[model samples]
Target: MQQTAERPSTAASSSLEIKANPITGQERVLTEGACALLQALCQEFAAEVDTLLARRKQRQQSIDAGALPDFLPDTQSIRDSDWKIRGIPKDLLDRRVEITGPVDRKMIINALNAGVKVFMADFEDSLAPSWEKLIQGQVNLQDAVRGEIEYTAPETGKHYQLCDDPAVLVARVRGLHLPEEHLLFNGKPIPGCLFDFSMYFFHNYRQLLAKGSGPYFYIPKLESHLEARWWAKVFAFVEERLCLQPGTIKCTCLIETLPAVFEMDEILYELRSNIVALNCGRWDYIFSYIKTLKNHADRVLPDRQQVGMDKPFLSAYSRLLIKTCHKRGALAMGGMAAFIPAKDPEVNAKVLERVRADKELEARNGHDGTWIAHPGLAQIALEIFDDYIGKERPNQLHITRDVDAPILAAELLAPCDGSRTEEGMRLNIRIALQYIEAWIGGNGCVPIYGLMEDAATAEISRTSIWQWIRHGKSLSNGKLVTKELFCNMLTEELAAVKKEVGEQRFTHGRFIQAASLLEEITTADELVDFLTLPGYRLLTA
Candidate 1:
């Protein structure tokens, strides 16, 4: 089932064709054992990943033809039955604050010591999946797992290392939709999720277990219960292969897609053996809402800024996630606080205040914990969650929130309130243009304006504009959104971006390419599923 490596100093799988240049640290991360695990994972589960992705397209076609997602009748009995997931480890129980970022060595060190309970080293949204970045990231995490990670800034010569009490580490693998472009197994690209999960788990699972933790994960972009089942099968298969305990590989699934909300109970049941929590992947969920209902004029969203967790649909989403998770004896982790800390004192204080308020809302709404992009936002979130849950408790899982009325599907899919404006449209256009530029340039986590823009937030920016133009929606200024209007505004925004970033940076940067790509997708005949798919081409080339 495995192909022998053609060369000693290359990707270790002969069955897997290495399509990209080998990075400096690729050898250790893609060791023979790691390649073997990847081959095994692909052999057993890769077909299912393709099938599930095809299922997503089939469902989207139905949605385009006027069908809405609802609870699964086939899984009603599973949802109704009283059951709980396998027990959580001690370190995972008090995850009141968790931070997520690209798996950069320095960033990983900083985030681990950021005073959060967990640091999710991300291989998904936050990291642009360049071959060098992916290989280097695996190496960094391997070092972190062994407590030998350290870095020194070249310009400043500032050495950085882990603190005495670092946060627990979790890995967020790429979604099933993404493929590891650098490697192909059995004549098809290996699923990026399996590649990442295999590499990390093979290298670090033993070390983490000895340190009183397994290889915890944050599963993203699940759209249905069957996807959850696929992961469950994957987890069990890996555990059996590795000769580990059945429930050693714990995870917290991200309810990011529009359809996932309707199947939360079944999703929990599917992974109950090893799953421990459900994260409110709000940004992606918003993006999914726009994409899923793009054809429905009545469901058009307003300005991106107006779609906060307080909105009817988002609020219902948060509450339902908590209710579903807590009822199923799992932690309900909150969404990301996208705002980053600023340099100016006033601006920084305002940023902290915003984060605090957002965390407060989450805590009051019964989330067991929350996520922050920057390490600086950790204190604000921890203070809020700590005040709510206190030092005595690990999580708020005991609070099932059973008293609330049922959250209807309509409420979860309600149109966001507030007016779209020429300004909001312009902001969306600018952010999409610049964010795509950065992403294609091998950086996925970028600070555009004040907020951190990753694939999820950027997805909202581009798709919102497309949805507006698709439905001929009007701004508060009474101006109709059209392809022509959007194109004109995009040209103006591109100029503005060039001016702000200066002549040298703009000329050297990917502004023109980004602008063209942004305009193409934003004004497309149909909304693209992901801009990254196209952007990845530019990145790899």
Candidate 2:
């Protein structure tokens, strides 16, 4: 590994101010040097951020006019040409099992020591974007990088620490669409992507390099190759400014949107120098598929439970991801196994069996690794990969199936016969309430009914309700879904939750606020672009 120049100074700058108060002992993480670097990044790239966001809106308008996303004509040459990403870093090569969670202190320690090959410390969907949570998450990352992270719960006296050989750390920053309200430049909030990426890189890039790894990232919700190109520019600028090697910042782009699925080759080509792998963010991809085809009556999705990796559309997407990645010499990572272990012995055994089959399928499909939300499931996923690939970074098999443009588009837009059920509606209402309440309390990932529920799952739940209402979907029992029907169900579920959690905790916490937000978003005349935006406002306000 190459050494970088001397560390930058911690001198405060006049351009930016800290809008949020420092939490106890959090000043050390928000040092003057970190603020200065963030300021520089904001001032230099804020305009470009605006332009890119504007482009997203323009693209959305085109889609609303019944235009389908396809391969960019101008980028056809790059897609057709032969090219491969630069060599993979040693620490990231054999990522057969990766654990993911929010940046909570105990989660960071446990996930790193979870016996997996990689731990993605997420600041995006898995984290509730409270100002204190954001700053403290940076503190936790800094401590983990220095091998000094430890947590002792005040309630249970439980202790946590890192293992002798922890998994490689990869940070998933906020997507391009979010903004960090606490950090402002010239009276405008900084892009959340820039804030999270710059803070982690500015503080710990060299430290990670010293530990034989560099700053690895998982870029989220990218919709086009142009977006990838913009990130490449950001990486180049950050490297030049920090005096680090050009490719020190390795990234894996999450193909989570319908547009991104079509442009995988072009996205990789744009970031070949800094790219390492491409992950099928299956939950969000399904959510995006619903949102993209919102106006097409024929594209209405079935009940969320009916959709899974085995579904024709989802299977096609997964196969396409593996083919595109392997053809370009990059690792193809699989989606999450959100099933957490159940308490009942029989239930837990069944859960593990289901997860085992899922992992085996991924391994058989040539995936380099798969994601597990909880540490207990890691061994199951790891064992399947071990039995299949055995000491190899990834299998040498290639997907020879010829997936054409029409096939890819058709799969995504395919219709389903799964009927809506009253049980499904009730579950969605309960999940939205539960997830939003936990989110308001600063926990982003919550286990509900034997599955890990995050923003993506919540999005799918709420959006499905909205789509069902819009299309006048009927339940399996010959009941029609209407605003009145949903409202009646919401009321019942809310009471159930209150009774379940008890009056004291429910009243003191944000349960009511969570219910109100869920009702507002789900019942609105138009679908909101992101649920977190409104939820975030309640936090900041």
Candidate 3:
């Protein structure tokens, strides 16, 4: 089915100006119809989007005032009743291994051809959302859907093309809090969530449905069932507008936020018609947990590395997610394995073993699938799932586990003795600066010390530092965490980065800007909700 572009909406009362930054090949994807569709969606939903964002602030205020989130009392019946989501689409039924990365052209081709069951073409955490990058990401997805996506590296002289069989493509859009500065409706930037979802669904739904797949998505940073309901309404409206079946689009909500963890069943209930799975977005979940409980001394987290999945809080969260998802007959996906294979054989062997163990744990614990950041780890994850779930696509869903409210609550409030260390503080400072510099320069995913670092990791780094400083945390060396200490560490780390990246690159590049931005956010008296919002301004400038 060839796409029929809708003419740009011309109603003076509702017309929106398209202020997107021009890219060389953007015209192929951002058609008049696409703009019209996005404008219409934004105009229809902007007010409601504002209300939802305000609700997020209200809820955060409550949390800061010593309120704890629990299963909604009004929605207890939804949890009590035994109901399941709509059937999983055939293509998404067995997602034992999904690879995730930014939506760069080369990444789009390589990820799809990487042999994972699904490639989560990420526009959220893993993407640096410059206007050109965002628009070009949509263009890349459009071409990949048509199986015509290819890339030739200018420096490497290497060509990338799709293989005979490619992974299913699932797009992860930016969260609700973000705004697409380049795209405006009625003189205001539209929500990034609306822009990304509307554009992709507008252009690719028909083509994807015709190809035996539909527009699958991974919703991120959702804080409540109401937010899920908002997305449900959008899906319904888009399906009707596009003249497609009501349940054609399937989504998997990332159970990443503290509020979201308590409302998993409710979230699924809200989007029952189109929801298919729930993923353990571990990194952001940790960040959210820390941010949510920053004021409570007992809930202060230790070094970021100390907070692993094995921790009581994370383990309970994982177990509850599996039980909740499987109880609803939805796939319970595992968190990411962010460790990239190293060049040293000994290091690579140790890392691969850790990856294998992690996937094996997920497989055994009833996760239908897991995520791998690098393609090289895909086979390792796949083999674990294949060995454990052979012949049966997802063997563990049928097996049930018990999870009670007290268990979850206890885990959420679990105390840790893990100590902060000078090394950890220095590492966080170094990573925050390095990652932010790359992000400001239009690179979202950076490999530092053999791990794939993205926004989620970066968030944990900065937020942890902020929390430590705010709470007067003491490092193992008995030094109190203070703005002065952080500033001193930042200076040393900046010098190290300057030397590592070379003075020329450091000066001409965004390193100074990145360091300044990181210092400002980390030392600020008030916590900033997102690094991207301020960072986006720099990109636009």
Candidate 4:
């Protein structure tokens, strides 16, 4: 089996590859005078960076040196007469675990009744931003957990309906990146103090546990195994202080970052038995891809509609995740297929059809279950997963268990020339473009010429590709690809696609689209055909 954690870094090296800074790419040209002044100021007042770095280093060292609390409760010690998480029932394993939209509590209840093992009452990205909406969401969750929720208005200012029903599994709280105090909309922060929101979240977990409920969570922005380790340590601290059990606080991390994909095994290893599931997060994943490839100017942001699901890195990453999780007997969940529909009935129908088609693809590709944001599309996710499960065989793809394909390819194509090089921008594009070419030619797996390769190698390549694509640039480039060349290319392309994406532009969907288009240009006739696709025009910026 592949190691679940990263091996320690080998002994240090001397010379390192140097590349131009990313911040200087466009900013220097656009605001040369101001940029120079700012650089001067930074040189004079750079102590803050050192201070922040020192603090972070200290925090990590403290965590590493800290011992597991003696009061840490055993997760297995908790006994619930009504529910259990010891072992996934065989019947449940054979069936699908579905997540429904938060708008319709009725649909969620219905899905739970239908034997779904988890129901995430999403509050983060799915729910629109607002203080009132958030507080109301908490109340709704509390009521739902107690089975005292009411669908009918009680004439006054409340609604109450009593029942003895139990929630299949409840995920509460939201805003993973932003804390409650930082909650803002349209550049305005929402004001409402909960004394200490962190304490509130922790205390809520304690209360839920005391009520014989499992302490479950959906951890987002899991960037690295270290981040995962931090969450584990934090959970340990809370559990100890609250007099709760260790393994009782189960969590399913949302794979939402480039580094997280590469560090999946390590993150899982760190979380261990506390990890209940893993979901492929799409929107943020796409955003991260843009950030990853931000180095290449030619790979401008693509139109949202142009970003296809058939991209090479996404498929490989998704497959790698499923393989890793399944091999360890853990649930590998397909990430959310955001089924946003238009107000027009005709447009809505088209949207629903697209969602159904995508769900079908996910089911056929090896996803055990998927997410749906709209209640109207709840039946679509359920029905599609059910159909696949009933067939009695998992989706088998062109990509096999050989996991070293992409990693070895990456190493060969973008080898570590060993100078601590900072030329990731160019190398990432070249490698990604090449990967796409191979993928389009029915060569789904990366082929490493004249090098040792294995499943672990392939998984790392997929993970690395996804990470590079996430940011629209690689971390190194001198020995890989230079930042100046990338910035020049981006400057040229940005003039064309800026209008399509509009103002407040930060994503790089346009870039992915361009690369996808260029990859199809093996022949002149094929180039025309590729241009006809929506992505060609969208990729200009």
Candidate 5:
């Protein structure tokens, strides 16, 4: 069913070179026209992507050498200037609840039908970037855009189809740092996000326009306003190439990295013409906190669970984000709620209540919208937002949140208060290992221990443990977290995991490889920037 082939020459993409497995059922998505468009995107922007990535390393080296990330002095004028982003599209105004998941067909159908105001078809943290899955995800989104997306239970014969009114569809492309080695132009690898954006926009922009929607995006892991400028340029290039309006491609940037938090105002200024919102990417932000402060022993975090949104640093971050975005006429979106309704009545009630309290805090805090992993929590989020935002107002941009106390670097970087525990350490190892195993095995979003786990959460787990070891943080049980101790715990934890998942599945999955990779990352001389990068290489192995 698979065969190798060379693509036909196109005027625009004659220099494109792609080494990929046959796109079995996805040949139509990668036609000559689409490939040409992708080549153009790579040719115009891929070099800038490399330069930006190198800058990222330079900045990290500064952080590694005792330079705490702070606001850019040269760009202080942008932060202080009076400006507001361009008008938001009508469809994106009331994003009270948004569901995010990998761009698989069944998942896409369900998420779009989920009663949320928006559904983000994720090609980033929630997706395993195998070459086949990448192209197939493009094919799936094309079908969904045309309203021809469907899925049937191969075993039970039940069918699934789209509802007449589906939530607004948006795509979250992979971060700029990720590269698509399978596809290249002029001997340079394509940035993964550009590849995703180009393919989907090329294949479905016209159809989306006819349906009264445009190509919406959620940009992730941005470290500075300059990175945001890069995205703006790419969006502008696309709009010009297609002869569309300037703001046709609307985006929401995630203020996840510590460096990004310092430049919120500057980032919004850069994307003023095309961005509508700023999302608090809570999980990755936690990972970034550990990574950015890896050299500061005084800033080692407590248990991962203990570092909730209520922490002084995080609370300051949220309050600051809300104030900054509101000041610039942009929506301040909240982070994801990881809980799911359990089958047991009492347990599910507690889960719902926890999610409610979380959403209620965000709603009361003036965030215009929040994220949920499952549809079951949509009603809860909707009710909380409705109670706080009311029916007359579409959003809370009117509430500038200026009354809140000023947030400074001291508040944002203050060390959190809590105790580390051996139990939490074991849980982190299990979570990181299993998630990495599933990720490299071609599954990114997975359910482990009854919760939906993605690369973001896994990053938190991985980096937390590494930071713990690097600082020789001691657990509540009086044992110092050292390399030898970590290896011992890893061995025991691997056995416990093997026993939990059973021998059959353990034999078939990549648990051993995952454990090896986890140990390598957590014990390395320097913290691994991202576990997924090494995991991506394992896909070839």
Candidate 6:
């Protein structure tokens, strides 16, 4: 149920009066040796950063003057691109936090009151873009991030006031050429969009930093590792010019693009200096997957409702990410659970249950946190985390050695390829059939090869089936599905999957095998045995 608090108290009112000052040129404090070194560093690498900024500024000036630059560079960098990346080498797996309430006030309250370490003040995807609305949003975000309460919300048809709170509000700006997620200005994908946004953010950052505010940012839709490196370079310039610490600013990247996912490891390495955490970006990533792999026309954006968190690829990705983040000593947070369904209480209840289950699994599996989109959902989400984290953890189960994770990942992801080879198609079928068998039989709670599986884990198995069905539905002529027809289809598809997986010179087969083992297990006891078996990490003591 949605929990609404009583009206704002005097304390809430009192928190709003804090304001930050705008200060300039504090870099003169460096000692002679430090100053000389800093100057030398600037002279050596400043040109690269400066050139990028100058070009960006030039493009912005042209845009304001109603002109387009003669040439626009390709925004995407593929495997073949000769792009050189440089920056702080760090991974932001789960070091930070996310604040995603529907209302700004609610978001601020959750961050300030919940004891969460970081809070991203989202204005791009979360805020609707009406001209007046955007200005009001910008002011609200600026005030929130600045920890100031005196700013007025630009007057809208409805009267809303800004709140004074000492929350760490890291602003999320719109990205360049991102048309689907946000608006596109003029015909050209808003020239200097990122630069201008950064400048505005820097404007507020300088103001707040001078008042002893912390440095924070939530960078979204970062497609390339170069983007991470570029942002680092830009931050370095700002900090250097401001006479701040070398890595004063903190950031979290949203790996929403397929390319971003491919280079996630690299991006994590690049943003090391100030990188904090990462999200399992749901919507944008789904959208990107469809756009990238054009052949599978049938598997177009699945209804978001139909695409549950249990789907194999996403489930594995989520689990893998959590493990990856924790291994690196960073936090691994679960992805966003959208607003509690307003119209259907049943659906809302189910959503809450799934969210709770996911939180339990994440904490059990090793995650620092998760995100929700409403104030009403926040307390429950936190409670769920509390219950599982730092408590009696069940022993972690290990997958059977025979189950090849790389092969499993390949099989789960096979449906997306829609390739010409028979082996690719065969592997996709094998994975889907395995999913249907597990879901229909309630195999989630059963043991498979001595490993325990649960409902949440079961869903991953089911989703793989769904992904495959989506592919077959698209490939075949409106054919009615029968059990035999489905089984035959899978038999053929599994072969293709095997052939393709075999050819992928690079392999992470063990992870795929582990997924296969989880696909079959249904009970916690079984999981204990599975983990205790040779060659696996036991999550539970």
The 10 consecutive residues of candidate 3 with the worst lDDT sum are 1-10
lDDT of 5 by residue, 486-530 (tens): 889999999999999999999999999999999999989888888
How many residue pairs clash in each candidate at the backbone level?
2, 0, 0, 49, 0, 45
RMSD of each: 2.2, 4.5, 3.6, 18.6, 1.7, 19.9
TM-score to true structure, per model:
0.98, 0.95, 0.96, 0.52, 0.97, 0.52
Give the 10-residue window scoring lowest on summed lDDT in candidate 1: 1-10
**Over 4 Å off, model 4:** 1-97, 100-117, 128-131, 151-167, 172-176, 182-213, 298-301, 340-349, 391-541
Where model 1 places Cα greater than 4 Å from the true spot, the runs are: 1-13
Off by over 4 Å in 5: 1-12
Lowest summed-lDDT stretch of 10 residues in model 6?
532-541
Model 2 segments more than 4 A misplaced:
1-11, 392-407
Q: After superposing candidate 3 on the true structure, give the runs of residues whose Cα lies further than 4 Å from its correct spot.
A: 1-14, 402-406
Displacement of residue 344 (Cα, Å) in model 5 is: 1.4
Candidate 3 local lDDT, 1-541, one digit each (tens): 1122232333223456556434566666567777777877887787798899999999989989988877788998999998999889989988989999999999889899899899999999999998778878998999999999989999999999999999999999999998876656777878988889988888898899898999999999999999999999999988888788888999999999988998999999999999999999999999999888888877888899898888888888888899899889888999999999998999999999999888888888778889999989988898999987785654467746764454557675577669899998888888889999999899999998788999989999999999999999899899999999999999999998889889788888888899899999999998888898888877777
The lDDT, on a scale of 0 to 1, for candidate 3 is 0.87
Residue 64's lDDT in candidate 6: 37
Tens digits of lDDT, candidate 4, 1-541: 1112221122011111111122212221213332232233233322233443354345334433532111112321221112212343232253244554442344445434444445666554433323334445555555566565566543765443433443345453342233232222222322111111232243255456556566566776555566566566656655565576676677777786554676666667678746766778755565544433333333333323334455555666676677655544556677665455567899878877887887787777676777654445666666787787664643232223445443321321121121212332223333334333333322222322211121112222223333333334443332222334444443443443444345544252334443544333321221121111222123111
RMSD of 1: 2.2
lDDT tens string, model 6, 1-541? 1112322222123111111121122111122333333333334443444454455445444533544222113432332243322232232222223445322453454455444434556545543222223344455555555555342345644433333433355566555432211112221212223422443454566676676554666677666666678777767776776688776777667765544654555565567666655567655555444434423444443333345456665666566555444333334556765545344677767767876776676556555666655445666666766665533431121211223243233422433322222333333344433333332322212223212222222333333334434444432344433334445654454444446447452142332343344333321222211111211111100
Candidate 6 positional error at 69, Å: 32
Clashes of 1: 2
